[model samples]
Target: MLCAICRRDARGFGFAPHLIRVAAPTVKLCSMRCMDIAARLKGMINPNKHEAAALDAASQAGGVYVELLSRTDLTTWSEQEWGRLVDVIVTEYQDTLRRAYADDPPI
Candidate 1:
């Protein structure tokens, strides 16, 4: 399966909302890199505030960071539909990115 964040071949890393009942589906990721990206995107960690050192380290290691700068437009969806919507949106974004940069060398 494609990684939820980068559309790469997954290596088993994953994320899922922790709920006692009605758990959201798990999101498989390609690597810890995409996992961190997903976490930051979900607001689980504020990378801008708490991960400065890690971000700097990644930059030094030749990692290129891309962020979704605009707010997501999910206001039309009901709260009960958010989990499915999130999954769909993430997958779509990953596919879009893959196609958009298909010819580019890895960063």
Candidate 2:
């Protein structure tokens, strides 16, 4: 295995399995140092707990859309179904924005 961060021979590859099997399935690093560096490189090279939780929550909230879109004939949805899905998504989005700007002056 090669270090994903440095492309060097991955000395850290051995520990990768027990460390974070899910997140870095294919990523192999020469050492723990490279993994640490990856988390610092930003762009969620390794998302923190808060970031991961937020993402998970967002996905959960979008479950309706994902479920519907996964169908081969999503266009067959009834008007009410589409309306309900869009309404849920819009409400979730608005709530997120509301939380984001909670400390700012009211609109």
| Residue-level lDDT tens digits of model 2 in 1-107 | 76654445778443333243344444666666556554443212343343344445555666867685675365887787777766665556445533533333122
Q: Give the TM-score of candidate 2.
A: 0.35
Candidate 2, residue 33: Cα displacement in angstroms equals 46
Supply every candidate's count of residue pairs whose N, Cα or C atoms clash at under 3 angstroms. 0, 2
TM-score of 1: 0.35
Using all chains and alpha carbons, the TM-scores for the candidates as numbered come to: 0.35, 0.35
Each prediction's whole-model lDDT (CA): 0.51, 0.51
Encode model 1's per-residue lDDT on 1-107: one tens digit a residue: 97765667989887764532334556778888777665545523222322343334434332121223232455754565555544555545554454433433233
Q: After superposition, how far is residue 4 of candidate 2 from its true place, in Å?
A: 42
Whose lDDT is greatest here?
2
